[model samples]
Target chain A: MKPFEDVGARAVMILSPGDNIAVAVRDIAAGEKVELDGRAVVITAPVLTGHKIAARPIASGERVIKYGAPIGKATAAVAPGETVHLHNLTSDYLPTYTLDEGHEFLKEQHQ
Target chain B: MTIQAYLRNDGRKGIRNIVAVTYLVECAHHVAREITYPNRDSGAHLIGFPGCFPNAYSFKMLERLCTHPNVGAVLLVSLGCEGFDKGRLLEAIRASGRPAKLLVIQDAGGTRSSVAEGQAWVSQTLAQLQNTPRVEMAIDELVVGTICGGSDATSGLTANPAMGRAFDFLVERNATCIFEETGELIGMEHWMAERAQNPALGREIVNTVAKAAKYYAIYGHASIGPGNADGGLTTIEEKSLGAYAKSGQSVISGIIKPGDVPVAGGLYLLDVVPDGEARFGFPNISDNAEIAELIACGSHLTLFSTGRGSVVGSALAPVIKVCANPDTYKRMAGDMDVDAGRILEGRATLDDVGREIYDLILRVANGEPTKSEALGHQEFILTYKSFEPLGPACFPSAA
Candidate 1:
């Protein structure tokens, strides 16, 4: 059996060799114990099969790591083993918009 | 293993010898068509943008098409007051040593007058272009691009990977290969980053995809399209994994934005998302927009993989359709080049289908018209958008 799978991880999916995070090949429930490098860490959320989680703890304003690089920044601190998603994270470069923000931005740009 | 090719003045080699008629704005499109219609039997194609706006990207893409290796000459049709700079565009073609002529409808008199003038110019250009000697071409001199549209689950399983194999073969021969639609690459960023030749490049790959995801997310559209969902794609990552498969397993040497002619030959990802705010709308509103970007990057031919089956081909380059679904191929064989669906039919191996695509690229590059070309599908559309130049990190290897 593959070394990553020997520990019951469905497949060892790496975003990049530099990335600390490996997406769950199968769904892992919160508090369920899964072994990484033989070290047991409980699932912090109901991470869907393909959604992302922190491979390590990230500080606010720090680059949110995925594929081993910064995709966005943590708007708030996130602990390792917790779900990293839109709720707590946002792209620093291309910021997400609420309806009001979009309206205001478009008005300013066009005006 | 090298095929014979024609090397252009700019040091690019052509697989096909073609003449193109370009309509600068929507107004002169008919005159451009008239010129191409009479010379239609020849390897001449009609291409143009419909907008009157002066878009730097549009000018750059049109310039690329006019001087593409496959094109031997160009005829420009202009409505006198429109913003497309015909003189500058013509000069670019002339600098490339290809025959080029321009007709301004308002200046020439009217529609009938312009059509007559355009026809005359095209005939003259065609004769001169024909008199130009053909040069030896090769498979290694080719620039090929692959794009998947209306993709379904079968795309990744058969068509995409099969096309990837063909890309691998092309890249092995030193042919330039391009695959794009970063919006589709949303979830597969990490998978793509790992394939970069270096760690920084790997990071750049991830950054490139992240930008695209953010661009699409702001527009309130799913990165994966509706057709993708109907075809069984669950998320952007799944679509990306399937889409990225068309690039084959080559190390992505560098990244380029649209209209940046490839300087090195290897598999490169085209960053399709606009560089700044998502003001003009979705990065690429449709598949042809993606196709245009590929051409702008110097693709001599395109490999189109479809599961639900798209029959789109570009005006500037030949598009080889590889259908992934057996049932779709069965329903659309006349519109397709290779039925990768045969893999599911149990009648062909992926390698066998790949070889078919490989051979098809050579044949199309050698002057065989694709089904879309034969059917006179020279569709083109360009819209307004702004982008800041790529950052230093975008082309880490270029320097």
Candidate 2:
């Protein structure tokens, strides 16, 4: 195995070298520094494992792409280094229920 | 090409050598535990049903387990008043030519004397089993089972599909692979039915799930648990989509009940839910019960997938744990076998992890102990449950 120089402790893979964003291998603390391409992108916020990060700036409601496909839409603004999590991102197809608006039981029964 | 195995007198081949100590009811459980705890390394596994009520299902399962290929010997601990048919069970084990003895606590004047007698019996039995001959076995002779518990959405994407690929590999190699839990199959009934080799078998698959859903409804769980919701799965149907992926993509050859081994090599579903009224609340109370059932069906080993990360293995069979969630895997790598979480990170593909699981199974079968087994996690749980004999449609090929 070829050992790469230490850039930071961010998760990445080499599917295509030019692909900008790397999926988080482990949960990234809010202030962690990451190595992307040849540049350093310090994480502005925490990133949950299994969720995606933007290679470039994505507009609000724009698709948050993962696995080279769009998994969900951005609920709020996201920066290159900001943590993309449940707060700022949401699934495009499935409706996630919250405690306040408890219609989930009704939805299941009716379905 | 075949691997070496310990062939039992009952004609079953076991990958691991085990000595089983079973208590007939709760009263003699301590005596049974005392016998097993001190000699744990001798493959003495502690297994028993706690209820005093006589259950045919329990009696059958215990009999099958005592003479299981992995179990070279058995020591039966009886309270002297439980309803379990100890006579029948002893006959079954003795008939198999395995050394088996009974220690009745009530008759022996209770705990200390019973434990002393039980330990002596176990030592004698182990010495006899150590002399049992070994034989070479083929992959075609192997009956393997898989199950996923504490499932989340990521489980379907990574661990379940990875296990599915491994299942497909085993089936192609002429090994019988099984996945179970009809209650969890509710949403994928149609899809699962379509995969059956024949149309009648398809209907049988659907009927099994329908029966399970109805049973759970009456028993009051409604196919939902708080851990599932916390893990981000919304409904039973959604959970089903993830849970059903453990079967992989193979023609559903047959459906069988616990203790019923597959006649030939292919993918089979064990219809764990009972027929008629819901006698047992859930088909499996915990992951250990699921593994126990798998072992009962003659599985030499088990592939256990988990997203929340369960650390459990059967007493008789090695359980290879496949970790699904990256965060969970990071937290519990010591407890896991393969980290399928790498697929989500793009560091590894589904095929990579799938092959990893298959390779792990082969290695474990050839005498590589899994992490759970190495940790002495011989967790065994068997409660009361009833299952009807599978109908003719369940196994079209066999007919």
Q: DockQ for each of the predicted structures, in order?
A: 0.04, 0.07
- TM-score between model 1 and native: 0.77
Candidate 2 lDDT (Cα, 0 to 1): 0.77
Off by over 4 Å in 1: A1-111
lDDT by residue (tens digit), candidate 1, B1-399: 445566667777776667888999998888888878988766667888888978887888788888887788888889889988889999999999887888888889988988888887777777766655556676656788889998876687678888988988878878789999988777677778888877788898898888887777687545555566456444455566668779888888778888887776788888888876677788888888888888878888889999888988777788888998777887888999888876655577777888899998878777778888887776666666666676666566686
| Candidate No. with top lDDT | 2
Worst 10 residues of 1 chain B by lDDT: B229-238
DockQ (0 to 1) for model 1: 0.04
- The lDDT per prediction is 0.74, 0.77
Model 1 Cα displacement at A86 (Å)? 20
Error of 2 at B325 (Å): 1.5
Count backbone overlaps in model 1.
9
Q: Which residue pairs clash within candidate 1?
A: A19-A68, B3-B137, B3-B138, B3-B139, B4-B137, B4-B138, B5-B136, B5-B137, B5-B138
